[model samples]
Target: MIKDFNEVIKSRRSVRFFLGKNIKTSIVKECIKNATLAPNSSNLQLWEFYHVINDEIKINISKSCFDQPAAKTANQFVVIVTRKDLWKNRRDFNLNFIMNKFKDLKDKKSRRKKKNAVNYYKFLIPTLYGNFLKISGLIKYLNVSILGLFRPMYRQVTSSDLRVVVHKSAALAAQNFMLSMRASGYDTCPMEGFDSVRVKKLLNLPGSAEINMIIGCGLRSEKGIYSEQFRVPFEEVYFEK
Candidate 1:
């Protein structure tokens, strides 16, 4: 049975050890499917998930992760990746999708909406993502800074900034994947302590691709959780307008 949303959130822990019991590959795939529904920047969807089920590959990945207990004991691994290099392809995909959706609408309001969406993918995205050896981004950043002095302007135009944006989206999807796994009566531990170079070579990922996180997945062992959850204090973190 699926779990309630609050229960799923509260129950999730950074499981350090998992039982030898195996989890269903199909169920993990379903959780990944749910992950894709996560909201992203401009709907670019510049992310990929690698479900490492093969024992050989999983072992190599665990080695890359320094064979931490979470990595060594988990039944499987899910690697989330950010593909900032694929911006053009994703831009065209959204462009085509939006165009197709609005193709049949001839009303004035519909046409205006279509034009705005079309221009966003066609013009704005290219301007933001089409950097020439980082020069373009620098120029765009300077331009935005100058314009911002006079009026409110979008500023995060540098290549590094965009990379952060893509990774943030991937991390959001990773959270969704973990929560979905919890809801399905499974567990996961998101691990960043890995050799990105080795993991990329193992996965045959390109240089422009980035490893967001590698999640260890399975049924948590009795001693999987190290300690009770801790927090500074809700009042310290929460604020009101």
Candidate 2:
């Protein structure tokens, strides 16, 4: 029961340097467990966390991140990977959420008509006979024609919005981990700056998993400096009747 949420928020900083001190495994586990409690689109939780602790593994991650000094300097790195196969689930979740919010969609017919037209013109035509087209420059056009037609067929049969739901859930979990770390007297950094392909290869990940973001956790170095960033006032960021 930490009461002062602002204290945690103020204390949380991107700690780039470390003192070779390791955060206990139990602490990490607890933090992760707290993160899993974060809400998601449909509670799909479509994310996996990889903890990199070995020196060589850390070095490789740093290299994949364009050789940023922070990557290698942190005590540990938590690599966040989302599943690509589950992205359709996310899309479905988003669609459903939209429907829920606007149950009386006055322009449903128009929207569907536009969607259908785009599908036909963009995806269906070229797919069916693109290879037969001899016009070298029009090959892409032919492919688009086929895709336009097939989009409707694919869209109708798709199942679940697991990706959107899961990624949102995963991000919530990540945020919890960061907040918990700060509350427990630790510093954390969320990083989206990395070569995803290289990271996937390094982790030997399956094609289904997509790299989302990396979070590093550790004690801050004495020399590390940070500036207070600004945020839009609450009145500007929120709306109420």
Candidate 3:
């Protein structure tokens, strides 16, 4: 039976040591499918999950992670990647999907909505995501900065800003994957302490692609969790505005 949502959240920990027991690959794949349903900026879905099951590849990835306990003992690894370079393809996909959905609707409101959606994918996406040698990004950033003085304007127009946008979306997917694993009686550790260059090379990823995180997955050992979970008091972080 699947665990309750609260139980899953409370049970999840950064498991540092894993039992030699194996986890079902199919379940992991299901969790990845759930991850794809995570909300992303403009539905671009600029993320990729590399589920490393091969022992040899996992070893190399563990080396890239400096053989941290989580990496060293993990039964498998899931690498989350951010693909800002694929924005154009994703935009086209959204456009095709939306156009097809509204194609049969001839009402004025439907036509207006379709037109807005088309403009968003065709014009706005290119304006924000299209960049030439960083020059265009700079120009767009400057344009937004000036426009903001007169009215509300989206200022995250540069390439770097867009990179952050994609990474945030990918991170959300990562969280979904981890929680889903917990719900399935598996554990995960999201690790950023890795030699990204080596990890990318091992994965044969392109230069434009970025590693959002590497997650170690397995059934936890008895001593997996090193200590009791701790958090800053909720009162300190919570705010009422």
Candidate 1, residues 86-166, lDDT tens digits: the string is 999999999989988889997999899999999999999988898766477878989999999999998989989999999
Q: How high is the lDDT of residue 74 in model 2?
A: 78
How do the residues 159-233 of candidate 3 rate in per-residue lDDT, one tens digit apiece?
899999999999999999999999999999999999999999999999999999999999999698999999999
| Winner on TM-score (2 vs 3) | 3
Model 3: per-residue Cα lDDT at residue 69: 93
- lDDT computed for candidate 2: 0.68
Off-target runs (Cα >4 Å) in candidate 1 are none
**How would the candidate models be sorted by lDDT, starting from the highest?**
1, 3, 2
Give TM-scores for every candidate, taking all chains together and pairing residue i with residue i: 0.98, 0.64, 0.98
lDDT of each: 0.95, 0.68, 0.94
Worst 10 residues of 2 by lDDT: 153-162
Candidate 3 ranges beyond 4 A from true positions: none
**Pairs of colliding residues, candidate 3:** none
Residue 195's lDDT in candidate 3: 98
